[model samples]
Target: MSDSDPVKGKYAAFFRGCPVEAELLLSDIDSERIFDSIADALTETGYIVLPAALPLGISDALFTRIASFEDDVFRPAGVGRAAEFQLNPFVRNDEIRWLSSGDEVEAQYLAWMEKLRVGLNRRLFMGLFDYECHFARYMPGAFYKKHVDAFKGRTNRVLSTVFYLNPNWAVDDGGHLVMYEDSVEPIAKISPLMGTLVVFLSDRFPHEVTTASRLRYSIAGWFRVNTNLGPHIDPPQ
Candidate 1:
């Protein structure tokens, strides 16, 4: 943040004497501006697609981390949750490895997301309790059928986010995320370019990944509200 930053500038006096944790971020990235824009777009259109949104260094580091993983680290992705989870290759052919802060690079990415969660909560007034994410890899010819991340009051997932890590991606790469509304025709087709970020209401749009010509990489995450009450939990142990 700079002396001329609008978010910090506008709230400087209001947040004067506040603890360092109160601030959105201490990173060199323009997080305040980017997060504010995301909040605004989500408010107006329920979704927003940003190209090259992340800082170059962080993006490159994340890409390197996921790319260096061994094949055995990932497991075939499945539908549903916990006991309801089951593999079906027809629905999705990709593999994923859940993210955790134990690793340095993964911790860095999650730290940024934690800041984003706070920013969105402050702006949107939503009870976003936490976030969970995974690295998804679509190998050559792999694809995922259209599906929504959440369904109204049934799921804890409130907002979904996807960050692309494929550097030097081309239009002919053949792996595009297609979003849909009420119409049968798709509304948007997004290329998996490095540093691109996509955010949307988890229940609002049905989306799918097209067949990949080569390896496609991305981080898929969700902001969730706590659903733990007494004997029942959102994710059963």
Candidate 2:
């Protein structure tokens, strides 16, 4: 995970012209400081928004991987999971492809998140067991209405993460993630800009994705704690 490391050559080319491109590895960057900031933010505020948080090497690879996918590879995103799953266009109108280790780029992203999971557990003792995420694509005009990622006791998801991949996003591009508090006024209106990572307590925030004026891409995921349901220990799906 260094500049001279063999693995760096494979993904480094992708970052050449990107605005946030720094070809930084987790080791090259101040990962410890980043982790500390995330922990402190979660303890004081329910959410944290970070700009250019991901190392450029992996971020570029992720952008390329998602951009290469064909339309057929993505399915309509749905509500709920397992037996309760259903496509509710009124609630969410995006497309998705679940992330898996089968692909190198996706695996790299997952590995990066693993570092986060472990770091947070050590700092906040959040008991995060694992993570699952998907590549979400919102074409022009797509939107997801206000909703919480999880309910306190009804789900295992404890933290939610959104990492954006849209470069040079304009202020009026319209794809802002509006986060609300108890009184209905928004606490933040986050732009889905490149390399911006948002982390929040899943059950404590209500958020919605405003309609996008152009195509949008992001990796949205959750850190889940182990929950038992007879023989099953995770998502029943």
lDDT of 1 by residue, 1-237 (tens): 557644455445534554454354444457878889999999998899989676676689899998999999999999988778999999998999999766656766776787788789889988886789999999999999999998888889999999999988999998999999888999899999999999999999999999999999999999998777776546621
The candidate maximizing TM-score is 2
Candidate 1 wrongly placed segments (more than 4 Å): 1-29, 229-233
- In model 1, what is the error at residue 86, expressed in angstroms? 0.6
